[model samples]
Target: MSEETFQRYSAYYDLLYRDKDYETEADSVARALRAANPNTHSVLEFGSGTGRHGRLLAEHGFDVFGIERSQTMVTTARSFTDDSAVGRESGIFDCVQGDIQTTTLNRPFHAVLALFHVVSYQTTDADVDRTFANAARHLSADGIFFFDVWHGPAVLHERPAVREKRVEDATTLLTRLAEPRLDVDRHTVTVRYSITAQSKIDNQITEFQEEHCMRYFFPEEITSFARKTGFNVERSEEFLTAQPPSDRTWGVAYLLRKRT
Candidate 1:
């Protein structure tokens, strides 16, 4: 959560996630939330980077408020929304700058969401538990919480040790490299990023680095944690499916309801 990291990558995030289809993912998450608690109207989105998912939820008729850790990301998100006609027309989006573990809002929401592996960014059990507790604090009675994270089994199996890629547009070029570190006892994976970008005309290259650590929990462990946090531990499934999670699943998505 460094300003330098976000400042370096703000312009590239949208391009990197262009194929992610957050709108569809948000719809899927919203559907699950609605099924668990049909009366949801207000939503608080944690780690809402660049507001991609938040915008989608707002357009779908939820009053969406976003919390982001990076001011640069929030600034870029604000500009992106400002430039969009749909965003201007909807007017249901609000962005706040804060960390997921410590941020406070004035009012509770009917649903809370942290999508696109944001939950994985918590590298330790304490961090993860604190984030869940914070989410619970922001939930109204009978509110539901939804989030997705990288499945442990998938990470251990894939064991992505190295990757390199480049992206270019008319005006700029971006180069990215990823190195993975595994902490088996903790079931956590940390990816160190090295990014270099250059302007097409000036050819001025800037380099930056960031580390993203994601803790992978067993499905039962997640359920137990949710229960301890006063959630009803509704169910969890492989991403985008109703099927039970398996070793082959790359991610797990959860639906937890506030104990009424």
Candidate 2:
């Protein structure tokens, strides 16, 4: 992954996704974890972003640690924690800046999570393999690994299209345009993002561009990764809804249990 990925984007990340239902998603994750192992207590999250999910998971009564690739995101998460009363009181959530493929916390957790299509961000085989291995390393025996990814069937059937979103805060108006190019053979979609931000106070405008490549996965391929990493495939379902994945399902969640 590029070092510059999400560097500038992290500043506006929360604003772009402010409407997302983090609570519901976290609830689903908690249910999945408990169903896999009722004793689950500690959680290590990869691609933790600004720690929204981590905070919710912590509130669910689990000790949550997060690893994010962007230093800006890590700082933002920590700042939020320091400012929030609940965060200071509970103190069950913390995060650091690190890559999922290379960073080793040297401690095991009862569960590991890579939500919000974080695993799909690994666009290459080696990257995916290393990420899975890292997850395995951070998990206790029979620990659960749960993640969501773009489903191959859905990606292929529906196809990606250009889209735009506009959002604003008191200080700034932000517009983002996304154009996608699908590589059928590679099973990847490269999304080019163009963002324009205008200051509400001074009307000053700034623009930036970034490209992200995401991989969609098949069930068999995910099972293959689990098998190679000493895990047993527990289940797969549509994210949040827990419905069986089909061509209509865009995001699918998978549960894997690390073998003893």
Candidate 3:
């Protein structure tokens, strides 16, 4: 993916998902961490866009490290952490720019996370395998892994719909439209975003487009991958809740543990 893919989205990312409850999501993560390992003290997050989750995790007393591929996102995430009191003295959240499939830190983490469809971004077999390998390598023997991805069955059953969203602030008015194209054979969906922004202050308008390719996943496939990578599937369920994954659940979270 081109670095500029998120260049424009990074500017309006906060406004676009202004309603997203990062704190709630972080709470869910914390609960999972506790259930998996009561002594959880460190976390490694991939595709930590905007770093909100990492920031919240840090606030909850976990030392958090994030890896993002987008330079613009890395810059913004760093600014958020660097400007915080925890960042200045506690050294809680530290974000770096790197591809999750290949990037590895010198030390291991107690918990590894790939939230918000970060795993789906791996559009090929090699990409998927390499990502799993990295996850296993970076995790301690007792480490747990958490990831959320689009459910293939649900996506095929419900199908994605066209969406339009408009958000505004004192200085800018923004409109976004999404057009989705599905490749049933490849189990991939390409969502094209058309964004229009008008600055109320200067009356200037800017428009841009971005296309994101997401690969939907199935449970059996995950089980196979986990076994191949020397890990066991501990649990799989709907994200942010205890509901079991079914044909109706579009997003599924999988909890994994290293095999003893």
Candidate 4:
């Protein structure tokens, strides 16, 4: 997705995904991180939307730093603080605005994460390779690089389709229509989102459209990319579950370790 798309999408991101179980997902991530590296302490998260996962990971005893491409999202994420009893004045989690493919911190982390199909957003070969390289660059030796992506076999088997969702909060009603156009050769599905939001107080309606091109990946390609980027593919399984990838699984997670 482009920065412009993110700018418009950030406003309603939390509202749109309010029903998503971020806690459970973060728990799954924490479990994976711990199982992969028992001593895992610091994490660098790519595409950390609103710092929800980051905050939960911090609660799991990890110092989390998030890199988000959208400045609006970074600002919104920074607004949230740690109100816990062990409150540190430094805040809960930190987020910076930067692209995953090129951003560099010149620092190493115990774990690197790019959740929520952030890899799939890299629609091109160069983008995907550079993203992998970036992850490897920031990771400590023997550290884990965990990420989820659109499974190519499943994407091809089930195919993309049009879908609509209606969600409302106390003050507003939001309806979103997703229309997908698939390109087999590119292994991409361009989903165009048409959202209509209505304010309950004045009954005012606002509509907007955004396009997101998602790339699906086969395990062989992922392994190849990992090898080229100085990583060994440690595990490949369904996200939040240890099931092997198959035509039935759309979200597949891969755990990779930087070569020592």
Identify the candidate with maximal lDDT: 2
- For model 2, what is the alpha-carbon lDDT of residue 64? 88
lDDT of 4 at 152: 96
lDDT digits (tens) for residues 1-260 of candidate 1: 33354555666888766678777787887788678877888999998898888877777777788898888778877876653326544537678888889999989999999988888877677888888999999999988889888887777777757999788888878888989888898888777889898889999988888877667877777887798888977878887877787777778988888887
Worst lDDT run of 10 residues, candidate 3, spans 82-91
TM-score of 3: 0.95
TM-score of each: 0.91, 0.97, 0.95, 0.96
- Alpha-carbon runs more than 4 Å astray in model 4: 82-91
**Candidate 3 lDDT (Cα, 0 to 1):** 0.87
Judged by whole-model lDDT over C-alpha atoms, candidate 4 comes out at 0.89
lDDT of each residue in 1-260, candidate 3, tens digit only: 55566778878998898888988998998899989999888889988888888888887778889999988888888888754434443438888999998887999889889988999988887888888888888888868889999999999999999999999989999999999999998889999999999999999999999988889999998998888887899999999987999999998999999776
Q: Which is superior by lDDT, 1 or 2?
A: 2
Q: After TM-score superposition, what is the CA distance of residue 173 in candidate 1 from its true location, in Å?
A: 1.7
Poorest lDDT segment (10 consecutive residues) of candidate 1: 82-91
Model 3 error, position 218 (Å) = 0.5
